[model samples]
Target: MSEAVDPGVAATSEPKEEKPCVQCLVPEIMTAWNSARGACEFVPDEKGREECRKELEEIAKDVKSIKKGSEVIYKAIKSSSNPAAFIQAQIEFAKTHNAANTEAILKWADEMEKAGKEIPEDIAKIVKFYRIQAGSQI
Candidate 1:
C-alpha cells in the first residue's frame, strides 16, 4: 500500500496563487531605503557596504525617473485621444510622490519653458503652485 501523505504537504498540489504582500510601491520602496541605510551604517565589510550605497543610489535614480515619467504623462494627457486612464494613473502617482517630488517636476517645466515649449496650462499651474509651496527650496 502507498504511504498516505497530507494534501497540504503534497508536492504535486497546484501552486497557490500569490497575492499582493505590499499594498503599494511607495511603502515597499521606503522599506528598501531603510534596509539600504541599515546596510550602509551597520554592515562590517567595506566592499559590501559600498555595494549597498551603489544600490541605494540606483534606487534614487529609479525614483527620479518615475517622477519624471508621471510629470510627462500628466502633462501629455491634454493631447491624448482617451485621457481618463492616464489622468487616473497620474493622480495615483501624485498620491505616492507627495511634496518631495515637486522640485524635479518644476525643474522639468523650467527646461520646457526655456526651450520655447508651451507649458500646458494645467501643468504650468500645478508646477507654479508647487513652486510657491516650496518657496526658498525652488
Candidate 2:
C-alpha cells in the first residue's frame, strides 16, 4: 500500500515556472556585494582577502548576466568601498556595449563630491570626457 503524500509536499516536488524580476534581484545582488566587501575588510591575511575577492568576482559575474544588469553594476560602482573593481566592470561593459550614460557618470561625480568622497583624478577625467561627449551629442 502507498502512503498518502501531503499536498504541500507534492507541490514542493514540482518545479514552478517563474520569471525573474529585475527590481527584486538588484537589491539582493547589491546586498551580497556589500556583505562580501565588508567581510573583505575584516580579513587580515592576504589569503583571506583573496577569498573575499573571489566571492566578489563571482557576484560581479552574476551582475553581468541579469536583466538591467547595467543598472546593478552602475549602482555597485557608486556604493562600492573599492570602486576600482566596479569601474573595471563598467569599462568592460562599455567595451562590449559601446555605450555609457553620460548623465549618469556626471551625476555620479556630483554625488561623490556632495558625499565628501574624493573623486580620483582618472575618474574626474572620465567624467570630463563624458561631459564633452554629451555636449557633442547635441
Tens-digit lDDT string for candidate 2 (5-121): 877676346778786887877776675555445445444556655655665676577675755534544545555555665455445544443344666677888799899999899
lDDT of each: 0.55, 0.62
- In candidate 2, position 112 carries an lDDT of 92
Q: Show pairs that collide, candidate 2.
A: none
Q: Which whole-number lDDT from 0 to 100 does residue 23 have in model 2?
A: 80
lDDT of 1 at 59: 56
- For each candidate, give its TM-score against the true structure: 0.29, 0.32
Q: For candidate 1, lDDT tens digit of each residue in 23-136?
A: 455565565444334434333456645654564565556563433323333333443333554345445545545644676787798899789999889987888888787674
Residue-level error in angstroms, candidate 2, position 9: 28
**Which 10-residue span in candidate 1 carries the lowest summed lDDT?**
66-75
lDDT of 2 at 65: 71
Candidate 1: regions farther than 4 A off? 1-96, 136-138
